[model samples]
Target: MLSKFVAAAALAGAVVTAPAAAFDKPQTTYKVFQFPQDRIPRIDGEFSDWDMVPESYVVGQDQMTDQDGGHHNPDKTLNIRVKVGWVKGLNRLYFLYEAKDDYWDFSLPGLHNDTFEVVVDADLTGGPLIDVQHQDIWKPEWVGQRASKTDPRVPGSLTHWYSHGVQAQNYHIMTPHKDKDWAMAWGSPTWIKNFPFANAAQSYKFTPGQSGTYRLEFYITPFDHADPEGPERSVESKLREDALIALGWIVIDYDDVKTDAKNGFWSLSTQRPMFGLASDLPLFKLMPIENAKLEARWSWKVVDMDRRLVAFHDDSVGKATGWHWDFGDGTSSTEQHPIHAFAKPGSFVTILDVTGPDGTSRRSKVWDVQLR
Candidate 1:
């Protein structure tokens, strides 16, 4: 049976005791360690059309660089790689990385002013992680992340998530973005409380042991994007918003991943959700991203219901900027808009189609037209 996403709180990585017969085994589960690399494979993403290979490790650490030098500004492509050591019995999987940065930059204007990203990529050899600290985006006229500081990661420091900002700042949609008040729950209930993001070459667990040789799908859920009308209503109905978002993951192909050992040696990357206030299972998210906005406005008034369309002339609408009207009726003419009408109307569906700057077409439908 599919449980609510909030199941994250109860079982978010080592935060609590393993339930009875969690992996068909007792509480004593298997463990994964880091080992010397054997060879590197390929990397891919479902959201992108790119490939990467582990170049080298970040001196003294198990951090490997997996890149073709493309993502997130060459200087910012500062990614590090990690892989799980072979586990035979294959008990369970869990991860709890160390977050060593604490400078916040708001994505929007006049709100929070600290920002960072937790990006992950998997290769045949292992998976690389990236911690982005940014600033200076408000100055640009683009519609994307703009961390304006010359030094993004805590301004010369790698602070943790609970540093300057409150605990678990990333998941709760901590901001003054356009419309953030409605965040009374997590997108997915399995979200890690107080800090869902993780570090490079971190740790994670997988259960029921992926049967034999199949693909190890990797995925990610962005920090502050929400879909009120998402397809998985049953999933959404369970956990809080963050957990829901955590489950709304991103994945990389199986062919792009390569496990070091024979059976269950594949590298896995996962995000866990927890309750900041309580170490309770079934942790629910009662917060907001507070950044997204309410798009279309509701409640429009129709002024003259029984008005007149008094049109005289209207032709093959000249490749005009916007369409005009001559309804051929005496209901309205002073109203210079796209809506046209007819004097002898019994039932008509007024279809007003328009094209935007991107050469994309759209339409508006008005029904049950009666000139009587």
Candidate 2:
């Protein structure tokens, strides 16, 4: 499954083509809020400490429809929804990823198995430095996997899934873009092996009301501007309070059936609509430690098209105690999750103010309520 991408890119001369206007940009950048608790969540795969954080962004398949080959819905392999979370403290930056998929097939002799990947800009540059035509993108700084083989121990590569389909792979953490050769890129760097703060864990669950779900909990010691061990980090890599870092993820699904053929291994890249191209990794910005101030964020869904009724969810950061909503009309609401019906449809400004113990912050959006 994974090998097909490397093979395609090897033959194409480049993994990603020049950014074309037709290939619309996906919502790649998201905001990470401060964790409600002072301590980090244990790598136990529970959402106890993460329920309050907002999902920074979501990537749909609209952007990929223009690719030469028809675009694959990146989120469909995982049930079309991937929720991500981030929180930062003085010592490290934490991340949480949740995917909805029905099957959990790790059985593998080939590379086509259920796998999840994450790319973070170790340098926090928002984008890559070697931008030819805005083509070089931030590659995977960390990757996590579960229920895979544990043989042929390597620093960064995974053991064959066939060998240990029921156990976790030894190498969940990986660093990409170190080498041009696909095999060499799997070599783990010394920093990856020696970094004391880098760690990851995964867990699975099957509930009555929900599909089979997988969650990932991990953290990386934020870097400084100084280049660390290899070429992966430059003067740009630094994880600081309010640091804006580029981040993205991919979920590959085998649909409970295992096979070595590309047809069985359907893949999705976070921002790369054209397979696993290096140029399209989306970004997620880190927020400052939670305090009295506000980190206003939200997620919404359309309830009615003609009536113009929309539902908005507030996932604000900081210690907010009060909320005020302006629904574009003279009417307003104090509800955190408000459903508003616009009297007339065109473009209206929706505003929200979240007040906390320390202060108040405002968030506003221009909603274009259209007819169904």
Poorest lDDT segment (10 consecutive residues) of candidate 1: 120-129
RMSD to truth, every model = 22.8, 18.7
Candidate 1 TM-score over all chains jointly = 0.19
How much is 328 displaced in model 1, in angstroms? 7.9
Query: Which tens-of-lDDT digit does each residue in 1-372 have in candidate 1?
Result: 112332344334212222322211122222223121231111221211112211221111122122212222222211223222211122111121111111112233322311112221010001111122223211111112233434334433322211211111123222111223211123222232212221112111221122121112111222221222232321111122122111111111111112211111111112221111111111111122122221211111233446534222221111223432223233323222434434464544333332323332323234434454
| Per-residue lDDT of 196 in model 2 | 48
Error of 2 at 33 (Å): 2.0
Q: How much lDDT does each candidate structure score?
A: 0.22, 0.45
In model 2, pairs of residues that clash are 123-237
All candidates: TM-score: 0.19, 0.45
